[model samples]
Target: MSSRISTTRVHEAGIETLQKRQVELAGAQERLTSGKRVAKASDDPAAAARAERALAGEMRAQTSERAVEASRTAMSLSETAMGDVVELLQQAREAMVAAGNASYTDNERRGLAEKLTSIRQQLLSVANRTDGAGSFLFGGQGAGSAPFVDAAGGVQYRGIAGERRTEPATDLPLTINGDGVFMTSLTGNGVFQTSAAAGVTQAWIDNGQVSDPSALTGSTYTLQFSIAAGATTYAVLENGLPTAVTAAPYVSGRDITVDGQTFRISGAPASGDQFTVQPSTATLSVFDTLDRAIGQLGTPSRTAAQIAQGNTDALRDLDQSMSQLQGARAAAGEMLVRIDSETGRLADQKLANQSERSRAEDLDMTDAISKFQNLQTGYDAALKSYSMVQRLSLFQYLNT
Candidate 1:
């Protein structure tokens, strides 16, 4: 049996074929002009979704990079401020050393004190330095104004005792703790402090050393002197309780070891004179240390022994302050290193995100142009075929 086809059906099928060809050609042209394989979600749902995710990731990476830059800038400024603080402290130390010269008269000592005072002011300024954005470098968490305030007692840190951080995937610190760097330094030799009793004009004590670390009780001790029949003797008392060294022969400039602590008492100590030793505490301030040294230097009628004692104590405290500030500066340097590492990581992430998005939606131009030409040729052939089929009427065929 043979199948019969209607003329209406033939014409309709031919027209539909041409319309489909035109639609494909238009799609190819759109891809070529836009340079995107997936211009809309309806074009390629999966590819479009992937591209959207990659774009979001790329934007996040960019935001994080910006945050890293801000962190780097703030940390660098903070580190520089800390360095300036160290330098100023060194200058103050030099002036303190010069003040200790025995040959320098009272007026000369006063001049040195003035230099230290100026240095203190400079240090305060450094402590309150801003990050060029109205934010303090050592402001800790945050501050509406200056962090360090010079009051009647001494320099005080008004900021909170912590650090601010940048907002991003990479957590980074933006400030340093001002209290730890400026206010909370260990007193004396960072172990024990030695001092002569008040009003004991004849005796002066040196900064004590730890003779035996294991034997230290961290207790307060006193060395009391007594003279009997022209024979000077001293006793050791631990926490106000007499030890076994009662009435021991007293020798000036001799090492006195009590409870594993060693120090020297120079010059003749009158009967009833006493010296005290206590554990070192973190109650010293950099500014307060300088202030005490300045006060001692400016005071007149001080004995040679008193001057020597003052110098010894001041130098010890200054060394402690320097150590503390250096530690803080070192921390800032470490943070900078971290920022560099984070920057590199973020750069790599951004590149990966860009590549992912390109792969998901970007067109391969060479393949795209070739495909477009093929579609154009197919559409032209379809147009020619449609024109020929439409002209194939029965009357025309019969005449031929």
Candidate 2:
């Protein structure tokens, strides 16, 4: 226990032991106060770095969870909107068929016309559907307003040609074209049209005629049937001339003239009752087709074949229009489905990422508590040894 600079083993050993005790106490206090073993980098640089990384990952995951939920919600809203479009298209198709019925009274036909008009309005509404945030469903990136507008205040599409998509997951993209604009082609004039009555048939004029001939106007041809004779004979005349042709093409509905009386058979034409165009101009509109079909219903003047044929053609056109609309609806449905699937998949990915990040950054309370306890015990032991050794210093007992 002798004291000297280099030779005093007791003093050096005791001093070293006291320093060690102080370090132990510092460590214990830090673990108890902070509830962490590696508070600083120097404490255990490697462990601190790993734990810090894990904790950072947890924070990032928590933050991203909100965004993931938002994406899922957006996709869900888009799908719901698309469902409405399908319903509207179905209604429109039904109205078109009702207008085409041959047995319908004029009043009934007019009612059907009104219903057809309503379908157009509904179609516009479907095109204009918006999300909760007031963004248009089919407006592409510019969701500022309704996607459908109209000429004469009727329904027309105003949306962008392209589609909008959402990114909910990596390598998977979801689309929300709930407005159905993507599949439907332009729907006016050239799209849904009736031929001009005054001019010669386009096919005839195409054969190098100098000028298109004016069509006969305002004629009703009577078709008589004698079941006893088993004969269905219909008389035809163009300006009172029997311009009989074996086959007549009626791209547009026929112009009927019978016994100096004139009635225009204007509607979708049937196969056997096609006639030359009348001098009257061709009427075509979203409303035109339905109005004409309604007007022709239950007209006793027109022949049975003519009536039946007109209605059949009208129905067929309606079916064609529905076909087009259904295409758009189908496309919308496909996109909605794809979007929902991608959104769900993306949600799963986000959840996984969140879990990984949390694992990376979260603190293990149990492990931390155990470490702090061990540090406390070691500190207490070091204090006890320090007290015993420090009290026995060479001059301390003599002074006491």
Best by TM-score: 1
- Residues 1-400 of candidate 1 have per-residue lDDT tens digits of 9998888888898899889988998988888899899999998899999999999999998999888898899889888888998998888888878877889999999898898888988988888989888999888898889999988888788899898887847889878888888888888788898888876776678887889998899998888999999999999898999889899997888998877888888888889988899999988899899999999988998988788888888888899999999998898899899999999998999999999999999899999999889988988998898788889998999999
**What tens digits encode model 2's per-residue C-alpha lDDT throughout 1-400?**
8855532565567668668766766766566666555667786777667766655654554544444445445545555654564465456557656645667666675676567566556655655666667767657656456766666644445555555443332222133443333333333221222222221111110001112124323442322111223332334445545546323333223443333333333333322332332232222232333435545553445544444445544554444444544565565456546546655654565566555544534446777667667766766776676567656755887888
lDDT of 2 at 92: 52
TM-score of each candidate structure, all chains considered together = 0.92, 0.55
Residue 272 displacement (Å), model 2 = 15
Worst 10 residues of 1 by lDDT: 195-204
In the predicted model 1, the residue pairs found to clash are none
For candidate 1, report its TM-score.
0.92
Clashes of each: 0, 11
- Count residue pairs with overlapping backbones in model 1: 0
